[model samples]
Structures are given as structure tokens and as C-alpha cells.
Target chain A: MDQERIQDNIDRYLSGEMNPDERREFELEVSQTPEIQRLLDFNRKLYKEIEVWGKQKLRKRLDDYYSAYLEESDLDHDQAAQTHIADPIPAVLNKTPRILGARWWRMGIAAGITGLLVISMIFFIRQQPKVELTEETPAETPVDSLEEIAPPDSLQGRSKSKPGKEGEQPKPQQSVPGASKEKMLKSQPAYALSNIKRLPKSFVRAADYPQQLQYTFKNGMLTLYGDPLIPPLRLKLFRQKGRLLLQFADDFFFIDPTETARPLIQIGPLSVSDPQPLDESIRIRLANLQESKFTQSDLEVWTGTSPQQIYSFEEKNGKRALILGGLPEGENPLVYVVNGQTCFLVLGSSVFELDNAVNQPVVLRRINGASSANARLFEGSKEFERKVYKIQ
Target chain B: MDDNHLIEELRNGNEDVIKYLYEHLPMVESWIQANNGSRQDALDLFQEAIIVFYRKVREGDYSHDSRISTYLMAICRFQWYTILKKKTKQQESFAQINLFSGQDTGNSSGEPKISQEELSLPSRESYLKNAIEELGEKCKAILEAAIFLNLKMEVIAQRFNFANAQSARQQKLQCLKRLRNKVSYEYVMSLD
Candidate 1:
């Protein structure tokens, strides 16, 4: 048979549309022809995969619809519980196959970044002491409840931010079977950051305190430069695994003794409330720079190592960088940025190796050409592991 | 409910059944964690496992010898293991160390190396999906109606204003053939 005929037969057989005689002949021919058999097998697998693809898309659409419905339901319930028992009614009603949005690729990227952020969150849990709501601060804000917050449609999400009973960890959501899609919509797991305070503490803008703070992470201690009038508040925090996290509040920048953008390089807008976070990276010191992720980005930088390759960040001119462990010793691998805004390399790690190589930035060969991949750091993607460092 | 009933609910696409599956995510969560898989890995894998499980049950003669939760966990374990196996070059040694160290001690290191052909399955599947998306809005509507909604030819023909079920069957056949061609082209390009 011709290639076209064979292809059609394969399709017919896989689709379960073949007539009895046609099916018998095709099966016999398939057994005899190795290539034809492989084709049949692959087409069959592809057929099943297409079904799965459709199902996956359906699930995503359902998830979006259910989540939006749940967000509406949770408006009145301020004392946020960890798991919302799904209302069975909503899920059934909302199964009318609707594509949530055309930007699934973006969601996939955002999901990956969210995974990284979750890892950062796990790391955050280890370093920061549990958040204690000040007695005057209205109510205690626990991270558990904060994670469950649905984004406010019209500031309704804030009501849920109010701290739960003193120290009770919101119990892990238990599945209540027989719940309607309506219930599931209300009880969807906390997938996205629903509000502003839900942002991690580490990622707020560092430029908030221009003169009042000078944070330099070097030699295992965070060097802070604070205002002379106030007692210098220095935390003995150091960079971990070549990453340094600095936490700053919006109110901190409010008191600008000397109003100038001279020393305080603005990485992003320092604010408690904004649907979109800032998108900026500042090279505070050549060796160390802070990349504040307040918003989403289309292109993301990724570094992959061979399975056996062991590398460490080495301090080249006070900036610790991911240098191959066995490479012949050299200067800091420089990633050049012409415009202060659109940069080639932002020090993903907060902890910088403080050095005297201030104005002179080392430029390196882009041997491993910077490749772009889709990874959106979702809304409120910045800030994890809230640690305040005084710039000494 | 009995195990059989649980499987039935899954097959029926019960929202409660799906939600129950998700609630049991923490069970596989630990296994993924210890094996260097992230929470996101656990999330994606669990969902896929549930869908696969549902389809398997939807097929005839699926026995309910064990608890649904146990069965779900087993499916998740296999899915994750296959994913990891296809991933790492040193997966030969890695699979030996199972997600958790205790079970399946015998025939551990004797795992076979995944073939290039099998390795290409996922990318091919992804390519096939993209190809389907490019099948145009009309094709999407017709094909989705037939395959996803499981509509009969007569109903689909009337819905799309076809003259008769015969014409609709012919159109559906053509669509299937086109999809096969698109998927095959994608597979070949993926190999390249």
C-alpha cells in the first residue's frame, strides 16, 4: 500500500473506526511490516496522549473557574482556615469547558517559579522567627493563613489576613467527599498569592532606607550603615549558600533625611500594596547586587550543570559568583549591563562578597550564551526569609 | 463506600472523587520530597496520576482488590519513578534508591536503561498537543465534540449543520487522518 493509504489505515485502526475486513487486513499487514507496526503503536500512544492533553486543559479551566468562585465565597470568612471544605454544587455547574485564558505557557512558567519561591518559603520558615502580630497591630498574622488568602477582588481579601487564634497552625485541608464543584471552588488549595501582605519579607525594596541603612554582606557578617541619630541596629545575619536576603518595609523609606537617589539605588517600588511588584535590579556593589522581584518577567535565566560537575561560588573581587570549582583561579565572571535597568546579570544571591573593586566591574566572556526560558515569578513573587541587615 | 464504588465515582468524574484524590496528595508528597522532587513535582505528578487512574478504571475489568488510596499512591509512585528514570543519566543507580529506601529491595539495580525511542515519548506527546491546537478553530470544535464530549455522529452532524450522519462520519474520519498526519510530522521533527 502507498504511504498515504498506510497512514489512513493506521488512523482508522487507532480511532476504532475500522470495518471488520479492513481491520483484519490492517492487523495482518501491521504484523508483517515492522515500520507499520511501530507507526501503529506510536499513533495509538499519540491518540491516548491527545485525550490526556484535552483532559489536562479541561482540569486547568475547571480549576480557574472553581478558584474564582471560591474567592467570592471566602469574602465573608475572615478567620482563614487552612483548607476550605469544597462545596459540591459549584464544580458541576462550572464544567462547561471554557479555556480560562490563552496564556497557559505563562502559567506553566509561573508554576515553575512558584515552585522555586515555595522552596524559598520553606527556607524562610527555617530562618525567620514566627511572625508575631503586635498587640496594637490589630491581629496576629500567621503565615499559614497568609498562604490561603485569595486575591482581593475589591479589597475583600484583606479581611482574611486577620490573624487566626494565637498560635494554632491552620490544619491541613481534609477532603470532604460528596462536596459539589461549588464547594471545591471555595476550597481550592492556595495556588496563587491572593494579597499583598502574603508577599515574602525578604524581597521588599532595599532602597527604602538610603542613608539610614547600608547593608554589605561579606566575610560572614552583614555590614549595616544606619542613621547617626538613631542607634545603629545591626543584625548578625550572613549570606547563605551565596544568597543574601534583605527585608525592608515601605514605611522605612518614608523618613528620608536627605532626599536623593545618589546612594540608595532603587531596585523596585517599595510598597505594601500593589497588584504588580517592582521589576528592577540594582548593582549596589560590583561583587554583590540585589535582584528584587516585585513583578513578572517573560525571560528567565537558568543554569544547568552536568550531573557529575561540582562547583562553588568563589569570591572574585568581593563578589561571590558561581565559578567552576576546578577552574584555574580567575577574577569575577562579569555579566555586563549597559543600561542600569535592562541588565544581563542580576546577582540572584543577596549575599555579596564585599570588595574594594567598586567602580571597575569585571567583564567576562559569555561562553555559555545566556538563554531565555519562560518562568514568570508570579505576583508577590519577591520577599522570602525576612531578615533585616544594617549596612555597616 | 466500597472500593468499587470509589472507582466508579472516579470514572464518573465526580468532583468529590477528584477532590478526595487531591486531599490524599500529602501521601505522595513525602515520597516526591525525599527523592529530590519539589512540591510542584508532587502537584503535577499527582494530578496526572489521578487522570491516568481514572482512564484505567474507565476501561473494563479494573479490580478493586486494594483500597482506593493505596491504589492511587501506587499509581503516583510508578508515575514519579518513570519520570525520574527518564530524567537523570545516573537514574540506573538512583531508581535503585527508590523514592523511599525500604520497599522493592530485590531486582533493584537490574533496572533497564530507558531507550531513546521511549525517551522521546513525552516530547512527542507535547508536540502532538501543540499540533492539535493548530488544527484550527473549526477542526477544534468538531474534534472536541466528537472525542471529548463523546457525541454520536448524528448529534454532531446536526449540531454542526451537516447534511447527514454519513457526511459527519466522513468529516470526522478526515479530521482524524489530519490529526494523525499533524502528530506524525511533529513526532518526526521532534526526532530531528
Candidate 2:
């Protein structure tokens, strides 16, 4: 039999497309021929591998669902804690005031008798004469007087009540200077500072006076103004979550990369120049920013780096992720920004987006093509060698 | 979901079943930890148990005589015991023996008793896995679509933009040939 015929028979046999007669004939052929049997064995093994692949695909989906479940559970717990523990004073204060209905007449009689007794006692005390102050006398404060006047049973009840236990007295709100401001600062999401280093003096002069700088890219070249001491610094543009972020030195600015008239962004003291035309590379890269579907395995293969650890952390989307290691790193770690399902790859200053790159190595293979294009543009410049930041 | 519904979902390979399966992890974890296993060990053992359970369900070997939690716990206990027995070869501690004595361990059904060999992937399968990955994206997709997903050749051709079912079949065969060569090369290198 021809190899094609044998392959067809094997495919049909494995797919269960054969009848009993065809299956029996195929088994006889397999029993007589060693080569055909080996081929069948290889196809069977391949079939198993495909099954494994399917399982892995299923596992990936399960992992995603599990991550979302954990995130949701965590959020629910946090919200419950906030409602019950973080701020409870409002809950206590919102209770309806008790109405003293039937006991009002009896309470009026008791109050009239107490008022006559207090009037007689005050008259008696005035008649006794004033006491003299001495050096050793400790002044009786209002708090001390109130404590002395409090009923013994109420004092006992106060002593018995534990702090933070049910029915305990609400804590008095203490005023701490700048505490709210500090909390606000703490609550804000902090920029990742591990990969950012202090800008070298060569990049920007410390004495430059401008508070805001505007820069533009025209024909693949960056133009800056105001600071003659400043050399051409490498800039990285990437998308975090859904916003475009530009990073240079230790500072990053959120910008709308699509806007034709770039907004004046404030960076410390360096002023940047505006070019007559936008760079074609930046325009192309901005247009390419989109959602991608690269799997954990594809990331491992392309970057040639495995995660040092697998753990969960809350992402900006308010979902917890079991992220694999820090980020993509290597000579040319294609995708620099991976936020949820979106991925962006950096080639020099331009950022290109990759979509559904998993099981699609061709998208990643384009990195070589993009890199060569960058190589031709920047040739021998230090900008070509700058490490791409792996911003999570 | 009830056991019947869960079993039906698992048979359909619905990934939502994973969330349901995870509900059983804590039980399995506690059992493994009780048997001198660490949390990580419990996690690894439980994951293997889940895979075994999933495979059994897909293969229609799972018997509904026991609850899903009970079945999963049995698999975890059996796997952990096998691991401990291997680790401490000579000393069969009394606790380990007592742990399984009264337990069902899914032996009643005689279908879900997973051995260590069944839990772990064979070395050849690992080699085949690497070879499949090395087969580039398109070839990998074609093979998986045709064989694993049981997708029709016509559907595979349409999805992959092939000219026809015949072309898709040819492409799959070509990919299989490359994979065979790669696996053989890897086997030869391993021998050396």
C-alpha cells in the first residue's frame, strides 16, 4: 500500500471512522507489518499528546476561573470587614432614639422631689461657710466630679465591659493631625519603584528651570527644547490596564498617544520640543495596541524564562492574579506590558500590541522583524540596547 | 450542583466544573496534612487527584456510588499514602495503616483506585509534549483541532484557512512526521 493510503487508514482507525470490517483489516495489516505498527504507535502517541494539550487548555481556563473566584471571595471578605469593623460608629449612631412613653408622669414627680432636695442641700451647704484652699489640695476636675457622681452599678458595668466586645461603649473619635492625608496617600496605588532608578546627571541637568516639558516624535527622531545639556534619552511607551503610559528615567506620564496635538505634560525641569510631524513608527505602534491571548506556556517559551514563583496579588482591575514571576525579561522580551488579557511589546520607543498570540507563535516571530526594523532605524545607538521594562 | 449534574458537566469538559471541584480541595488538603504532608504537598497531591478524577469522568469510569467530595478525598488519601510508603520504605507506621483501614478509598466501585503510575505522566509523554510544542503554532493547532478536539477536517480547514479537508489532513500528517522525527532525536540524545 502507498504511504498515503496507510496514513488514511491510520487516521480513520484512530478517529473511529472505520467499521468493524475496516478495523479488523487494519489490525491484520498492523499485525503483519512492523513499520506500519510503529507508525500506528506514533500516531496513537500523538493522539495522546493532543489529548494532553486539550487538558492543558482546559486547565488554563480553570486557572483563570479559579483566579477570578479567589479575587471575588477576597473582595467580599474585604467589603464585609469594612462594613462591620473599619467604621462602626455610623451604625451605632443611626439607631432610633428610645421614647419614654408611660413613665413620663412618674419621672416628672421624681424630678420635682429631686429639685427640692437639691435646693435644700445647696442652702445647707451655703450656710456651712466656704472652705479655704491649701497648697497640697489637688484640684477636682470635671471628669473626676462626673466619675464620683456616676452610679455605682453603672461604674461596675463600665468596668466589666471589654473593649471592642458587644455592648461596650463606643470609642471616642480621636483627632490625629495629617492622619487622613497619610491614609489617602497610602490608599493610592503606588508606582512600582523596583525597576526604576534615579535619573543620572547626564540625562537631565538639575538646575533647568521649566516645570513642564513637551516633547514630540517626528520621522522616528525625538526633539527636545530648553535644556541644551540634556542628551537624547531613551523613552519607553507602554499600556497599563487600558491607559497609555510613557516612561523615561524615574518618571512616567499618562498620555493619550492617539491625540494629534500632544498635551503639555509636566516633568520636573526639562523642556522638550515639538516636531512638525508625528513619527510614523509611533503612529503605527499606537494603532497596534490591542488585547492579546498569550498563554502562560507561550510566555515561558518566548521569553526563555520561567516564573520564579507563582502567587496571587490584586491587580488594578480589582481582580487577583496568580502571576507567573515578575514580568517578561531576556534579550528581547517581546511583550513588555501584560495587563489582564492585553499585551504590548516594545521595539525601541514604539509600542506595538499583540492579539491572540497564544498557539500563534507567528505573532511573536514578528518580533524579529520589528527588531530588525528598529535596528536599521537606530543602528549602533545606545537606544537600541536599552532593556525593556517588564511593567505588570 | 448535584453529583449527577457535576458528572454531566465534567463529561462535557465544562471548565466551570473546576470551581465546583475546588470546593472539595479543603477536605482533601486537611486529609493530606493529617497524614504528615505539607500544604504544598497537599496541593500537589490534590491537583493530581483532580486530574485523575477528571480523566475517569471523561472515560466514563466514575461510579456515582460515593459523593464527589468523598471520592476526591479517597483519591487524595490513597495517593498520599503511596507517597509516604515510598518515602519511608521499611517503616509502615501504625497511623498510616489505620488511616486507610476503614476508609472506602473508592475500592467499593473498583474503578477509581488510582495508582502512583496513573497519577504521574510517563517520561515518553513528557517527550511527546515537548515535541508538540516544538511543532510551531499552526501545526500544533491543526493536530489538536483534528485529534484532541475531534473537530472535523472540513472545520479545521475552514478555521485554519486551508484550501480543503484534504490539505488539512496532509498538513496534519506532515506535522506528525516532524513531531516523530523530533521525538526520535530527543530519545537518541537521552540514550547518549
Best TM-score among the predictions, by candidate number: 2
- Cα lDDT for residue B69, model 1? 58
TM values, all candidates: 0.32, 0.33
Relative to the true structure, candidate 1 reaches a TM of 0.32
- Model 1 Cα lDDT, one tens digit per residue, A1-392: 58767776775555445655776687688778878876765665555445545565655754554344445444443221223333223534432322211122123322222222222221212112323221111122222222232221221122222244112211111211232332232223122212212212222222110122333444333333322111122111222223333333211221122322223222333333222222322222211122211222111111222211112222221111232111111111112111111122222211112111111112111111011110010111222122323232
Give the Cα error of residue A218 in candidate 2, in Å: 91
- Runs in model 2 lying further than 4 Å from the true structure: A12-24, A48-65, A74-392, B1-13, B56-66, B90-130, B134-142, B145-178, B181-192
Report clash pairs, candidate 2.
A225-A273
Best by DockQ: 2
Model 2 Cα shift for residue B152 (angstroms):
8.9
CA displacement after TM-score superposition, residue B156 of candidate 1 (Å): 8.5
Report lDDT (Cα) of residue B156, candidate 2. 79
DockQ of each: 0.05, 0.10
